[model samples]
Target: MMTILDALYLLVGIMFAATAIINLRDSLNSKRWKSAGFWGINAIIFIFGRYLPPLANRILVIVMVLLAGLGGLGRSGKPETSLEQREVRASRFGNRLFIPMLLIPLVTMLGTFAFKSLTWNGALLIPAGSSTLAPLAAGHDAGNGAGGRRKPLVWRRSRLSGLGAGGG
Candidate 1:
């Protein structure tokens, strides 16, 4: 059976492939052959990196470093968006601009509470209490701390905190 991590790796691989496709489109626009090759290779790594042996993975990493560090994979791309265009976009999408940002926490909140209650064949998809959630919840809690709403709580009983970051 594929574990949750396998699914996540597959999803990430898909995203990497998608990025390569997008970069390929960008390369076509700018006629940057180097950019095309770099992204194309990166896409290969993402899609196959997980399945490769440790030695091959290490070699791939070295190739990536050489391709990017010295090869300038990201250079020579023309600006697709200028400052005035960005300003116009911000004005055009006021308020809606935050929707994408808010969706992250909203998803985390819902996942934390809702997924905990999910079960398959009477066994929890994720156990009732697992540290797997701590990192995710820590980020959310840290965001709250930044707003000063959670600072007092954090200062008071950091020892009693549950999320990985420790707080009230």
Candidate 2:
């Protein structure tokens, strides 16, 4: 059983995914306006639904349905020519290319794990007396108040030695 917040999160995630797919489809086909108003309303519900009294989300849903109906009736009647059909064919080819793009997320996940391991080993390989880690050692020593002096770590140049010059 999921909590209300969990359900709402799932609902919002699905709506956003659907909106992304619709927008991509519209872009490929060169459509002027992608109807993402439903997604906008879903985002609002995700943010403010908990604060409102009962039935607020349902009322919003009803309003969206009415708006969609009105928008459907407002489309201009345009006959398609062979040129438009060729454009649609090209768009379909573009849509087919979208599937291979899934490899990007897979590669990113692999790279993240590999880089995390490399960074872990790099931190472990830091030699004692290395100037690069002097500030970190000082910060650790200050935290414990080394040599019986209980002075708090001052925010001076020593505190920032390990931070490279490209601080920005």
Candidate 3:
């Protein structure tokens, strides 16, 4: 029997593939071959790692871990909007910025609660088998679109990690 977990892995693979395409475009624009290669391999791994033999999966995991530890990934250098320009935008768009942020959660929650229509056979049209994954995946894709590419900063929204502290 296929489970929602299986569906989620497929969705994750798709997301990684999409990200790889974005990374490739960024690389093409900026001549960042390493960035392209990195995300490209990540896409492959996300899509195929489950199908690979255990040893191969372990090796890929090790390599990815090393690359991350060595800081092989770099950010797009497109100048972030200058703070002065940002201040102006913020002043002009005050409270509007919050709309983008709130939209993700709103859509996710709505999807979680209302997306799974009851089928004639009684199973949902969309699986909400993993309650958390449904909303999270919805929000994640939305967040990625609205947030776009920016410098790497610790995700502080969760109380898991922070400056000089373990995530746990």
lDDT of 3 by residue, 63-124 (tens): 76776577665555433445575567568767765664786788778867765553446765
RMSD of each: 13.8, 22.8, 8.1
Off by over 4 Å in 1: 25-33, 75-82, 105-168
Best by TM-score: 3
Clash numbers, per candidate: 0, 0, 0
lDDT of 2 by residue, 74-166 (tens): 221222235565566557666554433444444445434443334232462223333233233333333334322433223221222222211
Task: Report the backbone clash tally of model 2.
Answer: 0
lDDT of 1 by residue, 70-147 (tens): 754653233344557567766876776555456557656766776666777776666556524633544444444543
Error of 3 at 33 (Å): 3.4
The deviation in Å at residue 113 for candidate 1 is 7.0
Which model scores highest in lDDT?
Answer: 3
Native-structure RMSD, model 2: 22.8
Per-prediction TM-score: 0.53, 0.29, 0.57
Q: Sort by lDDT, best first.
A: 3, 1, 2
CA-lDDT, candidates in order:
0.53, 0.43, 0.57
Candidate 3: list runs displaced more than 4 Å.
1-8, 25-31, 103-129, 142-168
What global local distance difference test value does model 1 have? 0.53
